[model samples]
Target: MATSTEHLIDIDRYTGELIQGWERIKQSIFVILTTRLRTRLMRLWWGSKFNEMQDKPGNEEVLMSSMMAAISAINTYEPEFKVTRVVIEDMGPDGEITITVEGIDLVDEALRRLKTTI
Candidate 1:
């Protein structure tokens, strides 16, 4: 009989490749579902209008909430994207939080999707 370790290694080897392939599929699926979405959000978050929204506290909440909705949508659909880090640079009067998604590759993929839209 194969030892448990042998079974584990076989399982790991099989699933590892499967998981890697799934990562690409998930990203592609996310892009398909949210390409326009990512663009709209980039414009919403990084656009000059976001800066303008900073002028008022109430507007800030609205802006951040809108941005948060966008993010939540992405996370809801793409659980594998795996955000490793987030940075809140400014919780301004509008309560804007500057969020940076971790994983440069994920960031780059998202940027690519947004670029196609913008």
Candidate 2:
């Protein structure tokens, strides 16, 4: 519920205005998850690299590996979030991928839980 002006801006939108507290963190994670590694200029290591998971068998090991790598990489780019848990749900039947993350906001020292579909 914190509406600070310093929150992250929503990249998917054109407004470019700062987002709210939890929503800010949620959108940030979503951005991190969807971004392709090496796509960002000057930050070759930034991104979830989820693109590498495509065209491969969606097994528990592969999913876990991808999630773990992404979680670790997310921390590198977004130090504001210290992710404690990540749950990736492969909704194959729905043709959707969902990620749930629980973490602390380093800026505010508050616990936040966010879920996003990729």
Candidate 1 lDDT, 7-110, residue by residue in tens: 11111233554333334534433343344432555444321222233345554566565345445544544433433333334445554444343432333333
Query: How close is every model to the real structure, measured as TM-score?
Result: 0.28, 0.76
Error of 2 at 63 (Å): 1.4
Across 5-100, the per-residue lDDT of candidate 2 in tens digits comes to: 355555435467756556666666777878888898997777877656655577887787778876786677775788888887664544467778
Query: Per-model C-alpha lDDT, please?
Result: 0.37, 0.71
| 10 residues in a row with least lDDT, candidate 1 | 1-10
Q: Which candidate is the best by TM-score?
A: 2
